[model samples]
Target: MHQLSRRGLFTVAGVAALGSTGALLGASPANAAVPDSPRFDLSGAGDNPVAKKSLHANWVMQSFAYDNVHQHLYFAQVNTENSDRANAGDLWITKTDTEGNELGSMALHNFGHGVSIAVEPYDGSVYLWTEWMSSSSGFGTRIGRFAFADGTVLEKTSSAVQDRTPSIGDTMINPQPAIDPSTGRLLVRYKTGEDQPRIVAFDLADARAGRLATQHRLAERALPSRGAWGAANPFQGFTAYGRYAYLLEGRAGGPSYISVVDLNGTGQSTVVDRWETTAGQSLPGREPQGMAVWMHPTGPRLAFGFHSNTGGVRQASVFVKTQFV
Candidate 1:
C-alpha cells in the first residue's frame, strides 16, 4: 500500500490508513445494516470517553495494541521537560476495565514511531515494535516482550539488502507485524522505497540468529488518490487466522481490497476479495493502527479499532467481525 500524503508538512506524529470490508466496497447499506453495533457494553470499551486528554497525552490510545496475554492494553507516553518531572514519561502497559481506569502500569524506554503490537498466546506476553534511538544517535528497530515479572527485548538491524535503504528512521518503513499461531514464529513485513516499494520479511523466533527466514516482494502497484483535500481514504490493516493471513490494501486513485494468503509455507499470496472506499472522498488522516489486532484464543471475532478523522475531527471506532469464509 502507498503512503497517502497529508495536507501540510509531515510531522513526527504517526498516521494510519483504514480499510474495512464495507468502506472498501462502498457498501453503505451493508455496513449500515449490521444488526448490532459492537457490544462495547460488556468490555467497557464504549462507556468511557477519555475525560482528560492529558491522561492519554501525546499518546494516541489507538496507536497502542492490546495484550490479550494478560488482558491489558499497552501505549507510550512522552515526558518532556514541561510535563510531569519525576518520571521521564515511559512506555506503559495498563489493565483496561470497561470503565477505562488504570489497573496497573509498567515503564519502558522512549520508542517512537512505527509502533506495532502483538500478544504471544503461548506465554501470555505482549510484544511491541518501534524505532529506538541509541545514545550515540543511531536509530534502529527494537522488539520488546513485556511480561508480568520480567521481559525479553531484541534490537533489530536489517540484513544487508541490495535494493532497500538500510533500515533508516523514516523511509519506506516497516509494515505492521502479524503472527502465525500454527508456526510459533513472528513475521515482520517491511517496505523499501524502490520503483515498487520492496517488502521484506523477518523471523522473530531467533533474535540471537539475525537472519530472516523468508523474504518476498509485493508486486509494485501505484496507489489511488482520494478526491478533495480531507476525504476518508482507506489504509491497510492485517490479521491472521489458522494458516491464512488477511491483508487490507488501498490504492491512491480508487481501488482497495482485502488480500488473503497462506502464510504457513512458501506460497504466494493471492487476492481472495476486493473492495473500494466510501465516495465523496477527502484526504484520509492516520490509518487505523491496531484496528485489526486479534488474539485467537480470547475470542473468535477479529477485532479492529478505528480512530476516524471525520471532517477533520478524531472519533474512535472499534469493530469485531466473525469470518464468513
Candidate 2:
C-alpha cells in the first residue's frame, strides 16, 4: 500500500452540476436500464445542505458503514505505516451521527490495515475486513466482528486464500463487505487476475461463527469495464440496499463511477444502474474510497469518503448526496 502524500492539484466539481449528453448504456435482462446520474443539488435541502467533514491527517479512510437502526456512520481508518516491514499499524473505527457529530471511537492495536466495514442491522454488530503481514502468517485477510453498543470485538474469521503466496510485496485488493439488508448475508469481492471479481456470501450465522462460506463470480455485466478510463478500474468499495449492490470504481485523481446490480441466489448479478462521477466532482485530486447509504428525511442518501492532498496537507474527507433516484 502507498502512503498518503501531497501530490498534484485537481479542481473539485459536483456530479449534479454536470448534465449528461447521452446514456452510456441501457439496462438488459441482467442489467437495469441506465438512469440519470444523481445530482448534487444543495438547493432542495437548503443552506449547508451537503454534510462535509474532515478526518485526522494521520488516518486514511478505507471503508464506511451506516447503521440505519442507530443512525450512526461508521468509518474505518488505517494508521499509515511502511508496508515493506512487518511492523503493521493500528486500526481505528469511529462512529458519528448523520449530521457529522462525533459519538465515540475504538482503537485496535496492531490490527492490520482495515479495508472495509459493514454493520449487521439485525444485531447491530460491526464487521471490519482487514489485510496484514506477519512473519508466521505471511500475508492474510480476516473479518472481525465487534459489538455495536460498546465496540467490543466478538470474534474474527480468517478468509482462506487459495494458492496465495504470502510475501512482503504481495498486496491484495478486497472490497468492503456488502450486507443484504433483507437477509443479513454478507457479500465480499475478491479477484486475483484480470477476470471479473468473485463474490463470496457468508450468512450472518456463519460469519458470527467464524466459518468460511461459498464463493461465486458475479455476472459479467455486473463487473465494471476494465478500460473504462484508460486503465483497469478495480472495485474499490461496496454497499448494498434492498436487492441491489453498489460498487465504487476508478481511483483518486481519475474518473470514478458507481455500478449498481441486482444480486441473485445463483450468483448471477444483473446490472441496474451506473453513475459516473463527473470530472472534478470530488475533492481536488482525491480518490473516492468506501461508501455507505442511509435514509434521510428527504429520501435515501449516499455518503462516500475521499483521500487527497491539498496545499501540501494530506487529508481525508467525506461527501454526502441525495436526489439520485
| Residues 97-152, model 2: lDDT tens digits | 76655677655434445555676555435444444332222222443444543433
- Residues 1-325, model 1: lDDT tens digits: 0111121111223202123110211222212211212211112122122222222223333334455545554443332222322222233333343223455443343333323445453343444443333122222233333343223221222222111122323244434444433334344444333212222233345421343322221111112222431134343455555444555544333443444544322223343534332321232442343433444364544544433343433333344554434
In candidate 2 the C-alpha lDDT for residue 105 amounts to 66
TM-score of each: 0.48, 0.62
Q: Estimate every model's Cα lDDT from 0 to 1.
A: 0.34, 0.48
Task: Indicate the residue-level lDDT of 84 in model 1.
Answer: 26
Off by over 4 Å in 2: 1-52, 80-84, 109-112, 121-140, 148-175, 192-195, 202-206, 210-212, 215-234, 265-274, 279-282, 297-299, 312-316, 320-325
Error of 2 at 268 (Å): 8.7
